[model samples]
Target: MKIFNLPLSESTFEKRAPFYGRLSATIEDMRGKTKLVLRLLLLFVAKHEIEATNWKIIALWGMG
Candidate 1:
């Protein structure tokens, strides 16, 4: 007959595994979201500048 015994106490790393995983996941998500927002903001600014430049050109043409 073979007898097996499970661990009665958690190791230090095991005890902290969930906390570390959550922290790492949160950081990764935040970094991805930040990058996405920054890209969107940059695109919006570029679009706004293009529209403003077009308006300026139209105004200049009207004056000439």
Candidate 2:
């Protein structure tokens, strides 16, 4: 992946720390367990609401 002209290799993506992945995994895993995952979504949204955007990390995952 390329972000801000920086090249990101597969290994770099794979080597991301758990801090970058755990909540995302939790969100995916929670899918289908409940008819409405509003609470889970709220948690995610609320987090992003409070924190500053880290485009480098988001782009590392090909997101944002």
Candidate 3:
């Protein structure tokens, strides 16, 4: 992830298998605890990869 818009690490972009499975678990966890709008906003701002190909990130608070 990027720190102050500076390049961070290459390992951060490493492939993660079964992406949907892990993602589903997280969604279930936040289903009732957090509102949908808030969750979407958080996800949008917290972990944005400006350069998708490079997997560079601009994580603020990160995933819940």
Best lDDT goes to which candidate? 1
Task: Give the range of the ten consecutive residues with the poorest summed lDDT in model 1.
Answer: 1-10
Instruction: Residues 1-64, candidate 2: write the lDDT tens digits.
Output: 7544322786766666464589678777777556367878888898887664665567777953
Position 53, candidate 1: lDDT: 100
TM-score of 3: 0.25
Alpha-carbon runs more than 4 Å astray in model 1 = 1-10
Q: Which 10-residue window in model 2 sums to the lowest lDDT?
A: 1-10
Best by TM-score: 1
Candidate 1 per-residue C-alpha lDDT over 1-64 given as tens digits, one digit per residue, 9 for 90 to 100 = 6364434567866877788799899999999999999999999999999999999999999999
Score candidate 1 by lDDT.
0.89
For candidate 2, list the clashing residue pairs, or say none. Answer: none
Give lDDT per model, in order: 0.89, 0.67, 0.58
Taking all chains together, each candidate's TM-score versus the true structure is 0.72, 0.26, 0.25
Candidate 3 lDDT, tens digit per residue, 1-64? 7534422455443344356468778998887667877888887866564355245333432532
